[model samples]
Structures are given as C-alpha cells and as structure tokens.
Target: MGGEYELNFSCMLKPYKRVLLKLSGEALMGNLGYGIDPGVVEGIAGEIAEVVALGVQVAVVVGGGNIFRGVKASASGMDRATADYIGMIATVMNSLTLQDSLERNGVQTRVQTAIAMQEVAEPYIRRRAIRHLEKGRVVIFGAGSGNPFFTTDTTAALRAAEIDAEVIFKATKVDGVYDADPQLNPNAKRYQSLTYGHVLAQDLRVMDSTAIALCKENNIPILVFDLTVRGNIRRAVIGESIGTLVGGFCEVS
Candidate 1:
C-alpha cells in the first residue's frame, strides 16, 4: 500500500476517528535501562508528529516501568498501595518528559493526571480531553487511574473507552503478537492478526486480562506494534501493516 489505499485481501483498514496509543516507559529507556532517554523520546515524538500530520486525533497513555515497577516495590516490603502510588508518580514523570519533548518540536501537548495536582498538570476530565483532541492537541494521560493494583494497561483501556477511541495501539519492543515469548521460543509463530476471543482464550501476554476484556467489551481493537522501529507509529496510525491486530474474528495470515 504505497501510502494510498490498496485493495489487497490482507490489507488493514484505517477508518478510525480517534486512536489511543499506549507506550511503555521502557520504550523510552533507550540503552540506559532506566529513566527517560531524550533521543528515544524525540524519535517517538517524531513518529507521533507524522501521524498527527495525517489528521488523526491522538491520545497517549505511557507506563512507568522505566522508573519504577510496583510489583518490584511490593517484593521489597512496601505496601502495595504505596508502591503503586509511587509507580503512578513515575508515570507522571514520563508524561512530563514526553510533553516537554513534543512541545519543543511544536506539537501542542497536554499532561493530565489521574491523581489531582492542580499546580503541575491538569486533572483528567473526559470532556476536556475530548475537547483537546478536537482541537488537534495530543493528550498524555498519566498516574494510572488514581487507584492501586491496576496496571497502566488497564488505564489505557479505560481511557480509550471513555474517549471513544476506535482502537488502542499498544507499542512494545516486538512488532507483533506471538504464541510464546519470542526471546524464549526461537520458533514461536508470530500472529499477523488475532481475534479478541482468541487472544483472551489463549491468554496472550500482549496486555493484561482486564485491559483486553475491557477493550473486547467495548469493541475497541488493540494494535500491538514495535514502536522502537522508527516510523512504525505513523505506519500503524495510517493503516500500515506492522503489528498484530487484536480484535474481531481471527484472520489467517
């Protein structure tokens, strides 16, 4: 599909009014293994800029696995809720860094938090978020639903549903879904596309069960793609085939 619609039997369609992109904080870690990497962030922002140039309304929710993992803190004897709160704050850090990078590149960005901190960022309000989208401003939701024990994956589903996004784009290191961990299983078969029921029944690790169920219930598709591949974000947004589409009936590759 040469940047134009193709009538191929396996072509992916892009009729979405809006899209929610879920970025893992680890994706921004570059080679440091911790904290934000300016180069990586800029590359990611550049990809978003390309998508935005296509007139797509984008909303992003970034995880904080780059800064802290609540599960890890719990193993260290911290209260789960306290540890989760710390994780939420970590996400806020990523959201700020992303917003700063996008702003520096002339992309109007907003950082909304699940936990209220009026002086720093705007509190997440669905209507306000939609308004921002309508105005072509990219919104980054941070702080993970203002609750504990829920992963940022769940936050992406919840916000995507609330915002009426047609699909949830889950960007990861891998380009698509596989039956087993690609790192562990050298012969693992990669799925070109998968249905919601198939994905749930097989217990795929693309997203948490709660998030997958939420997206399934709301008829929102999840596109799992490799964002580390420069320009994949724009490709995914503009209907390029770079990942596994998780929703609807299973289609053979």
Candidate 2:
C-alpha cells in the first residue's frame, strides 16, 4: 500500500528470467465470496511487478473457478462439453481483467486465447507467444487449452512445454505439496521435493494426472509454492529451493 511496504515485499533477493506462473481463480477474490476484488488484483499485480522488475520474463495462466464452473454445472445435468465451453469463456473474462490490471502497473502484457476471439484477444500461436516472452511482454494464455474435459493445469503444462519454460510455478494456498491435505489433517507431512514417480504412486493431487504426465513426458519441472505469501513467486523462481519440485530430476535424452 505504501512505497516502503511494496519495496519491502519485493526485491528481497532474486533475479529471474523467463518463468511461468499459474494463478487460481480464487486468487482474484479478496476476503469475498466471488468476483474480482480490486485489492486482491492489485496485490497480485504487485507480485508480478516485483518479479518482472527482476529482469524476468513472466507468463501467466489464470483459472475460471471464481465466476462459474462448467464441470460442476455439467454434473447437474448440463452437457459436459457445453459446460466446459462456458468455463472457457469465464477464463477469458478473468484473463482480460488480469491483462488490464497488469498493464495498469506499467507491465506490458498480452492475452492469447486458444479459442478464436479476434476482436478480444489474439489466438494462441506457440511461436508468437515465445516471441512475446523474448520481447519481455508478459503473455497470458487463456481458454483452457481450447478443448473440453481439460483443465487450466494441463494447459499450463502444455504451454510450458511449448515455450520451453524451465519450470512451472504453481501458486497455491499451501506453500508446498504435502502427503495429505494439511488443512484437514494436522499431521500431514510437507514434501520439500517430490519425484513424479512418488507423486504418481502416492496419488498426490497437486496437479491433475494428465497435466503431470504431460510435464513428465516433456521433462519440465514443476514448482508448487504459496501465492498467498507476498513475493513468493519470485522466491520460488531463481532456483530458490522453495516448494516441491516434481518430475524431470534427470534430463530427458
């Protein structure tokens, strides 16, 4: 809120270049039931600003659970594909809002959607998106891989692999992946680092199995960290040894 306040939170220590940040839809909610909270949006933009200032090229993939969930609606009898399309639109709205917020802070951003929406945003082009990143423009990929039955998590992995991101940073409520849900189980053990095999064997829900498999096959690493804590994004990047690193322990041939 204040100069010193933001200064203290950012630039603590970390220099990063090129990272993928995954934000949940609920992150846009600030002590409220639903919708985008201005304070929450600004706070997150601050987090992005902090890292972008560190000479890092940032890309984001935001979720749509805040407004509506097509999957949940479909369970109530709506067609699954239709429900998913609705969910995809919801993500586009969230992406637009995020783009506006980031640009307000003088952070250059671009919104590329998988679904064709020429009037609103650019269509997803892997080479173009990579160029945007190289040019230091934060690119936000929206529309959930433009396919039904897939999730933003999977889309994040797909994009990360396409862009050659060193690691995918998943910002969650909990700081790191745990053996069990820490909230429900007080004795849950937090894993500082986890292998993809261990996660698959243990059935950890950090990311959907499909997403994990895609990243595993692509040899991309995943870093799960807490976005609730300010500047944690930057901390998790720059190889800070924060959160859980899953898969790709050995480089793929």
Candidate 3:
C-alpha cells in the first residue's frame, strides 16, 4: 500500500483519447488461489480512476479465467457451447465485482452485459455505452460477446470497434510480448513494437488468433502490459513506453 503517484501529463504523450482495456479474471486473483481479491480489484480501480481523472475514456472487457474457462471445461468433456455460456456468466461475476470496486473508489461506472440480466446490469448497447463514456462513466462490458466460441479478448476488440476506441489496452501478468517465455528464458527478447502480420506469422500467442485478427482488421492498436504494476494502466493510457505496441500506424519520428 503506497500513495498514488501523480502523473505529469505534461511530460506524457497521450495518443489515445479513448481506450478499451481488456482484463483477465486471473488478474483479479492477486496472491489467492482463485476468485476475486478485493485488494487487487481496488488497486486496479484506483489506477483506472487516475486515468479517468486524466480525461481518458475507458471501456473494459473482463475475462472469466479465474472462476472458469470454457475451453478447459470442454476439454474435461462438458458440452462446449454450454460450458462457454457458463464461462460468460463467470465474466459477468467478475464485471460486477470490478464495478463495485470502481464505484467505491468514487469512479462512475456502468456494467453492460451481452446476455440480458436487466435486474443486475444494462444489456450491451453500443450507443448507450458510448454515451456513458462521453459522460465520463467507465463502462464495463461483460458476458463475452454473448456467444459461444468467442473470448473476452474478442469482446474487447468488437466493443472497441463499435465504440471507436483508439486503442486496446491488454493488461496481463507479463509486461509485454516476448520472443520466448520470459519466465523460462531470462534472455528472452521483448519487442517494444510489433506488426500484426509478424505476430500472426510467428504465432506470438499474445492473444487468441481470432482476437488478433479482429484487431488487425479494424486497425486498432493493442498495448500489452503487466497489470501487476500499480500504475501501469495509467502509464499505458498516457502512451508511456512501458509495453509492446502492436498494429498501430507509426508516424515518422
């Protein structure tokens, strides 16, 4: 627990006014074995609050890997589609938890689900979600595109395209995409930037192929960074040199 660091926006290069942040359910687990960790959620909310205060509109898509994974269940002999629906529900749970933490941090938030759960959240509406962001509310998209065989990463890309997000901020356990597993190879090379074609051709595994292809098609930039760092989210938003930037137009410098 440390005090929030004040970002000097004057020194920062903010290339994105609006961003879609993709958070994996496992990111909320902290040091626990499973499920949401309140402290971790709050810390993430705090970082988000900082970015919101900086006038960066943020929309989030949370994955359900911590509670359940659809693919894993399918491997265990469960019906694929049914297990995927269950996984979507798990994402909704994570979204609610994150929304609660963000609200507690005094950040205005809206939770929109792909599957209509009117009692708990607003059904995903692209127009309404954009309106919420324009009004400075952080909108969270849940339920993974309301379909089986798709992922929250795909949801993030789809929503970003729908909402006209300037970039996709993919927060993960690792700092950035590397040529080899950094954990195993200490000398693994981390790319500061990568082309979508390179990622696809090399099979970087930074994101699902479908998700990567979707982003490549839409020409949306993806910034893959470590969520464990307290201020990394804000850093990513402000365009600090922290993570691997993929599939964006680079101006001649």
Candidate 4:
C-alpha cells in the first residue's frame, strides 16, 4: 500500500471528483494548547498531497481557534465584531502555514483570504478559487465567511456549495458522529449514516447550525472522520467508508 501503484489504485476507486475539507484550528494545535504544530501541519500536507495525486480536487476551510476564538473573546468583553475580525486574521495565518506545508510536500496550493491582504494571500474570488481547483491546485480558504459571528464550518459548507463539491469532509478528533461524546460515554453509539433532519433534531453539534442547514438546503453530503488517523483523509476521499456520512442516503459498509 506504500507504492505508486497503490496510490493510483486508490485514486481509481474514488467516487468524488471534488471535495471541501474542513479543518479545525484546534486540530492543528497537536498536543499544544495553542498555535500551529509544524509536525502536524506537515503530516496533513502530506496526506493532502496523496489525495491530490489521486486526481481529486481539494478545497479547505480552516478555523482559527488555535490562535484565537472570537466567540471566547467576545464573551470576555471585547466587541463581538472586532473580536471576530481578529479571529479572521488568525485563520489567514493558519491558511498560509498550510499552504507552505503543502508546497513543501510538492503539491501546488493557493491561499485565498476573505479579508484582503495583498501582501500575503490572494483575495477570495469564487471563480478563481474554482479555477485553481480545476488546475489541481489546493485552494485553502481563510477568514470565516468574511463576516463576524460565522464559524469556519459555515464557510466550508458555503464554499462547498459554491464550488459544487460532492461532499464536505469534516476532520475531527473523534472518528465519527456519536449519540454522545464518545470519550465521556464509552457506550455512546456511533452513527454510520444519518439524515440532515435527524442531526438537527438530535442536536448533534457536529457542525454549527448555520453550517449544517446550509448543506442540508443544498443537498450536499458531509463525512465526519478522525483527522488523528494519519491516512483517514485519503481513505475518506477514495470511498473507504471510514466516517459518519450525513445528509445523503448511502449504503454504509
């Protein structure tokens, strides 16, 4: 499974041509309490490169909690809007780091920020972003929907719909969606498949309400899987059935 042939084999089995990947800033923290972990970023980049090699188009929406959480700041007394703007900047920083790592992995990438910073990354243009993906360049979206009070999860769903992605791949610490926090409740049941209505009604908390609703309205599917598992990203892309599939009715293996 470590050779070029295997990579090609996986690519050949992929059911999706394009996808939107949602990365939480907290996941980039590795074991640290805050900030990006270089090793973790590099590993993620390597995993992305594998997907890219398999000819799947990838677009990413990254959160900024590792550096700053606007909601937390606002709750602590900063103006909500201002705190959220600062949080957007944090995402741009993470986006650049991800771009750098992807480039180092020999994968072409683009960092498009919703907030303009010409000196660093390109401003977000939906058409341009789609063009990059078509060219096999990884498009990394930063800044939370270019507005305050919006989570990166929403950004991922919005971008996925805009780009007409087949699915939204949510990489989380937990392997999949559960009836309860799996770590806290060992007996919690993991759902292999779920409907959008069921998730909303159950208050799954898998993604923010705004994000989940957006996907539901657009009929986009979501796959929630563990990012900690080194090859899970590539596995999910190639339809290995390794996650919790939400929104669409699909047979689960």
- Those runs of model 1 whose alpha carbons end farther than 4 Å from true positions after fitting are 1-12, 249-253
Q: Give the Å error, residue 247, model 3.
A: 0.8
Each prediction's whole-model lDDT (CA): 0.86, 0.82, 0.88, 0.88
The TM-score measured for candidate 3 stands at: 0.93
TM-score of each: 0.93, 0.91, 0.93, 0.93
Tens digit of per-residue lDDT, candidate 1, span 1-253: 1111111315455656699999998998988978989999998898887777778999999999999999999999999999999999999999999999888878899999999978889999999999999999999999999999999999999999999998899999898888888899999877777766677777888799999999888888888988888888777777777688887433343
For model 3, name the residue pairs that clash: none
Error of 4 at 218 (Å): 0.7
- lDDT per residue as tens, model 2, 104-223: 998999999999999999999999999998888899999989999999999999999899887788888887888788999999877766666666767888799998899889877777
Candidate 2 positional error at 20, Å: 1.1
Query: How does model 3 fare in lDDT?
Result: 0.88
Tens-digit per-residue lDDT, 29-135, candidate 3: 98888998999999999999999999989999999999999999999999999999999999999999999999998899999999999999999998999999999
Candidate 1 lowest-lDDT run of ten: 1-10
